[model samples]
Target: MIDFYFSKDQGVKVTTVNWRIHKLAQEGVITRISRGEFTLGSGISYSPSLSNKQISLYRKLKTEFPFLSICIWDTSIINEFMLHQPGRFYNLVEVEKEGMESLFYFLKGKNMSVYLDPSPELIRRYLSDEKDPWIVKLLITESPTQEVNGINTVTLEKILVDIFCDELLFDAQQGSEMDRIFKEAFEKYAISESKMLRYASRRRKKQELEIYLNDISKYRQQPNFIANK
Candidate 1:
């Protein structure tokens, strides 16, 4: 809005207004809310902390299947955005589908509770809230991931999409809590909507996710956005 006024009333270039906005944010005068959106609050970024168990499990899988693409992350990462976070959290290990069964057995051999691509029925029948378990799942091809401490981990974008799509698996992050989750996620992280939509498309939930995003966010329908990465 400031940029538009400057351009129309004072003949200032959009580039100059943008540069000013960037400099103002750098100096802490204004906060960047997505691309051009601005606010008074400070910026927040998402960073996942890896547990020893998560690290060790990732290493074992990497050593066993060095060529496979695997991502490891803990569900407790959502605690940063929740008021009713549960005491029990679990590990999520996603890899290509072909090696899923073998990896499940390998993990099972270690005497830890593990499940492979569980159904809602399986979750109800066997998954225990009293204990932490590792779930082996099929990693959607080209799902956004990053390497943290030399281990591949889930990105904020992927987590948002997963929670939106998997009601049974991510029951903890649903209903009213889901609204808060998405609102906090957008506020606290540099997430890319395009990347998230691509993953959702792979999961066949792109359209649904888009509608949900529109319902929850004002910036979701922006014509342009500068991805913060």
Candidate 2:
């Protein structure tokens, strides 16, 4: 049956096979131990069932959406780790979205650790610290606003305000770090004072607008005088 469904050169209706396999698993005829890419059951272990083509597609999607975050779903088991370690896996609980079903499917097979919902305070602390701009960008862009298991998306203005507020408490080194991140974000995201103010006005925080206006002037006037070789 497995060979009939999964033969490399054969044409088989994947949906039909998937449904049949799922039903059998649920009925105790087989055990499902992983995501769509792999499965294991009594007296059988499927080794690397996903095709090389599918693996290539997955990598393409991940590369294209580098800012895509798994934390936005309020999954209690989700945790962020250093990007250097590809071997690590983390389970994210409380994910209800259909899109996340794929992520959960992959993580379950890897047997990774899970972390609970991160507090707003912790997120705020990270924003202030300027330690991880990629993370900050992901949080602002991907967090859902209002829905079951939704993550709250921060406005662009709010992001600026948060960074500014954090910088007030920073020392020299921290200030340099903030400068580096802000410059990078500004260049990468094409951020401008006008764009920031537009978001700030919607939130009814004119004070924030005033601060940004001041900062923008200072940022613009800094001599771009690069020494020529």
Consecutive 10-residue window with the lowest summed lDDT within model 1? 220-229
Quick one: best TM-score, which candidate? 1
lDDT of 1 by residue, 47-68 (tens): 6899897898789889999988
Clashes of each: 0, 2
lDDT, candidate 2, 1-229, per-residue tens: 4454766536767777778877976876544333332222242311112234334433543564444443322111111211122222211222324434455445434443222233457545553443322111122332222222133223323444444543332222134444554443433332334444444455455576566555644443222211111
Worst 10 residues of 2 by lDDT: 74-83
Compared with the true structure, all predictions reach lDDT values of 0.79, 0.37
